[model samples]
Target: MIKNKLIILSLIGLSFISCNLKNGKIENIRKGELNPTVELIKVEEKKFILDSNTAPQPQYTQLYQDSSYKRKFTFLNTYTNSIYIYDYETAEYIREISYDKEGPNGIQRPMGYLIKNLDSIYIFDQLTNSLILSNDDGKVKNKISLIGDKDPKNTEWSLSYPQYYPLTVAPLIETTQELLFTGMYAWAIPDSLLEKFHFTSRIDLSSSKVSFGHGYPATLYGSEFNWDDPIYTAVYSDLHPDGNKLIYSFPVSHDLYLANLDSSLYKTFYGGSNFAGTISSLEEKKSSPSHAEMGVHIAGTDLYGGIKYDKYRKVYYRFLRNAMSDVSKDSNWKEKPLSVIIMDKDFNYLGETNIGTLKNYNWENSFVSKEGLNIEYLHENDINEVYLSLHIFVPEEI
Candidate 1:
């Protein structure tokens, strides 16, 4: 198993004609290179309801279908060792994908995953520490173990560049076929390589290569922008539907970065001038504890909802936490506002609008679909069975 995995990794690397880092190295972006915008554009929102009462509540990590959830909803039931496909409109089960625990194509501890190929999605199985590419129907088509069979995760060594870590991760879709993995606070990494690896890296499953993405500023609240603690890494990211341009939104400073393939990095602030200013100061950041003790403390009380490109309107929409409404206020850190920021492909600020308040804002449960923005709400009509509410943003013709 070890020899084959290594051979596979080597072959994948060789297949790539050339792998170049942006500029072939990671450099600190210049000052004034990224500026937040204060301009605001208005938008209209209509609500669509996703009733979860129709079936056994499905456990899904991400939503890939349209806002309507009518087309297809994919879910993974880790406890059951199965994945399900459902039709949202009729609440009908399309199909369930299941495999034996010790079979030829079994996945263990499916930790993180993202959408791929139009219908099929990628799963990160932690037990075997491999990236599994499933068919659109949820059959495990191919399995590529990222590390060695003898536990490549806890080791303290390096063989070459593009190193693979068994560290925890949250996978996000970048290109239709590629995945971007953001390390979940790896405080356990040895000192030699503690901060060496960039926070974000690309897993080119096709080429079997791992590469770096833009790292966050190192001084924002002690965790570096990459750290999930102190400031929650509520990074809303999306790629241009046409071009694979990377768009990033941080609720912490209201800064949006446009790092395209051909251009120098561009930055824009979404809300008003006070938006970016509301983030923690350098002093406050320095004084804050590096380790997140209580909860993942995002910089501003405001949190980012989600960001997506409006394929229909040809504009970008970013959901922000507006009015601080509480779900379980008695509980620590259970409030975030519900707001949206509008922008164009050029990063020009359009306007802002406020929806109601999110019950409990979990980035995992919010996604942007072709129809509208779908977010999970704990209280729907005061019923707390966990439902998804869609906020359809109609771009003002301005």
Candidate 2:
């Protein structure tokens, strides 16, 4: 069984005005005075047959649209160090990109990856502490060290690994001349750095120079907060389709932060869920809690996860983890309640709908498509090792 603590934290915004569909009629509804309902868009079940006979782990999957506008997904089979590709709607096997475990083109440990295109597949090799840019043919074109020359004396910050989500924020994003991603740091970092820590890191693809900016919201800093737990400081972001803006969602705040990549300008909007309140509270302590303890604490707390934009619907989907009544079983914490807050293109709050829980779903294996949000679904007794099942959901009128 996949650990809920790890997948739940990652695997993981907006506004709007507009119209509402009620009883099959279009009605004018002001924002903040409406409730959104969940509509079953469709379901897809596709099996991936591999020659090696090893099943692909759904936890490390990414869904992307090709140049031809066809939807496809890639799965990382760490067991074989291969990535399996499949058609999103049909589940047809496309091909597999296998990499060597050792050599000039080899990748030691791939913790996360992003696909800019078929020709530009970015993989984060944790063992080497570098990012490897490869192609669908499994040929490494470029390798860049994530760690640039920084003062060893500065305990304020460091880039150890890339933190990202497959559905919303990609691990590695290539812009005009720079690649952007968030970093994963150890919890033992100094508190002073936490006060004004930058939330993003940029690597100049040409110069290989690294820089950090887009500091966390003021709410994340200050003496009132504790940085001992990764859950409290967990942040997820995505580069806007516009190519110059970045959207950030904090685990504790209800407001979605929009920052301009070209400058230090940012604005916040109220895009919280009515079912649950914004702002999370934690115990005042110095040490961190066990994984099981953290899971239980999170189940009974209201926190946000990833915020993804649905270019197809012209809206944003922000996930909210509702507090659970029974935190007795941390093992099944994923079975707790969960919902999504919808916002318009302008970041106006539309409404929200409860989509049940992560009980049978792989949170990291979800992506946005024309059909809506496609989340990988699994049955309790599911034994099919080759095929993937997805449940699609979209916001609808009550």
Candidate 3:
């Protein structure tokens, strides 16, 4: 279940003059006043049947592809606490990097695994409250704990959020020097911890400094920040592959915000549809920590599927999952269709498509990989069998 949540967060932004729908250029009427010409690109899809011969069903699947694995579809299973490898063409189960849980170097209840490279991974170990660096062979190299209080560099930039480690990162912006992280918490911030609520922070690993003042004002989008849920949902950010620009969005509104890691640039393209009126009160948004509602994309089902930056094809994507208009709640949305809103390199509104409904909302069911956008049809291709049906999306230049 925990892995399921992380999968939803990672999985998904662009630009815009008057949207045209004629001659492959779709006409779009945005909720905002910006009437700009926009290009519409069609998507092509194919599926690489994932080899399910090795396991019954995975609890969670994360993209773990590298050159060593032939650049094929590889996944890390949270259920098994291991990596599963498959052939790109054949969908055959080649190997699994299964790890132990009882050893001195082992971890219990790992929050998630970051595929830093083919070899090493930073496992957020719940038991130790540390990120255990381990090799593909399950060898523990090191474990780095959060240097919150003991960092001698700056005492003011301390991480004071309770139980901090959701830490959503921009996929394309990860570098040796820095990484962008989302600060989503439900705690009430004191005056001392105001700097900690930068919304998006640039953690420079080389200098050991947490760069502040690089985030949009939470009060503007989060409906008055520092109220109850300090770790609000509106602060979720994704990387723009064009220049690795920081991208953010409002959950219930049609507002899309673009900025930089240093907070130097700021731009917004408010492109929304007729159903964009889906909104909630600031008081209602301040739900309990456990029940905090997230980005539904003006729909009822999706609870903030974080923005995704596709590096393979220089474009941005926002997955509007299971959108159902007939109801106000998410119960009926599970049977509705999914839409991938397309945007250009400059964050311009491009086009969108209804990718159909889904049965398995698990992370294993879908991902944007080196082989284009891949979504598995669980009902058609069963994991209980040898193969799973895949739905792939590629760019069809129109």
Better of 1 and 2 by lDDT: 2
Q: Per-residue lDDT for 252-363 in model 1, tens only?
A: 5455555554333343333322232233322224434443332333323455545677676677767765423332323344345556666776545666555455554333
TM-score for each predicted model, relative to the true structure: 0.64, 0.80, 0.67
Rank the models by lDDT, top first.
2, 3, 1
Worst 10 residues of 1 by lDDT: 17-26
Best by lDDT: 2
Q: What lDDT tens digits, residue by residue, belong to model 2 across residues 179-275?
A: 8876533343344544345657787877767676665443343344444566656776767879888888766666677788865445666666665
Question: RMSD to native for every prediction?
Answer: 10.2, 8.8, 9.1
> Cα miss at 153, model 2 (Å)?
16
Off by over 4 Å in 2: 1-57, 65-70, 149-171, 184-190, 205-208, 290-292, 329-331
- For model 3, what is the C-alpha lDDT against the true structure? 0.49
